[model samples]
Target: MEIATPMATDDRARFETLLSRHRGIVLKIAASYAWHAEDRADLTQDIATQLWRAFPGYDPSRPFPTWMYRIALNVAIGHVRRHAPHSRLTVPFDEALHDTADDLTNDRDGLDRMRLLQRFISDQQPLDRALLLLYLEERSSREMSEVLGIGESNVTTKINRLKQRLRDYAAAAGHD
Candidate 1:
């Protein structure tokens, strides 16, 4: 067995702290990719596991969210791809929209809008869904490129195309 160094212990502590601070990022990615509660939980756990395994390789100079998003998106996309053949992409919009009692009580219209948006996103391809998630999170094109391993110009082009697609979908659905 290998001995644990003091540095390893410190690193572990730091990783836990960062993970706790940014847990919502993992949850949002999981929720965006997973349609069922059980699947969301599994994706969340998988993301955490992957993050822990990858923590040692994280470069401190880069933004934490950037690195975290890359890992989370990769895991989420992989999970979706693996289960796509057997799974339906139907998200329980009402249940997912009202995540808390406060949300349930307030912002009914906003929740409805979010539910519709979620449905639109769920109908998209895996990469398009990922792009939408990153865009909704307000990540910069450069950041999206870094997380997605694509060129910044490609990220910009995709975002424009995605916006047009969403607009077209809304128009066709009579929500325009």
Candidate 2:
């Protein structure tokens, strides 16, 4: 009684590939938002789900990782929107649907401040997260505007504001 199940296999392979490449960054981003240890896996799952959901929407002309990053950040924030920010989130995992939110969050050291940075990062809209990631990666504002569908001036203004936001977080956290 052999069955021909192609879709499941394809989805699993796609998930494994994307997870292998982006899990670290996704984990980092999730841990930043979640304030507990138990939540990391949950949040990671959220990111994975979001990626899978957004996979079909991916554009070939655009860079894969950048597009993936957009999906990742968007899913993370969407999780927060659905679940309370401080509590551990538990959403049904679907390699197909994507996005449930993070469960990990613990910043025990100065290095942990990166999580807080993610908090600030995820605070913005998906487009803003993409913009900031590009800015941090040193992508030019013109390029960011193109990717984000905004004017370059808007990119500059947003960067200035985001930087200030990060600085404010650092100041409050005593990291700066």
> Model 1: residues >4 Å from true position, as ranges?
1-3, 89-93, 100-110
- Candidate 1: the clashing residue pairs are none
Q: Which stretches of candidate 2 lie over 4 Å from their true place?
A: 1-15, 85-134, 139-151, 164-176
- Please give the range of 10 consecutive residues that has the lowest summed lDDT in model 2: 92-101
For model 2, how does the per-residue alpha-carbon lDDT over 65-120 read when each residue is reduced to its tens digit?
A: 66665566666667666666555443222211113223333335533564566556
Model 2, residue 148: distance off in Å is: 5.9
lDDT of 1 by residue, 1-176 (tens): 98879999899899999999999999888888888888899999999999999998999999999999999999988998898899764354556666563745467655555666778888888788888888998999999999999999999999999889888887776667
User: What C-alpha lDDT, on a 0 to 100 scale, does residue 33 get in candidate 2?
Assistant: 47
* lDDT of each candidate versus the true structure: 0.85, 0.63
- For model 2 the TM-score comes to 0.57
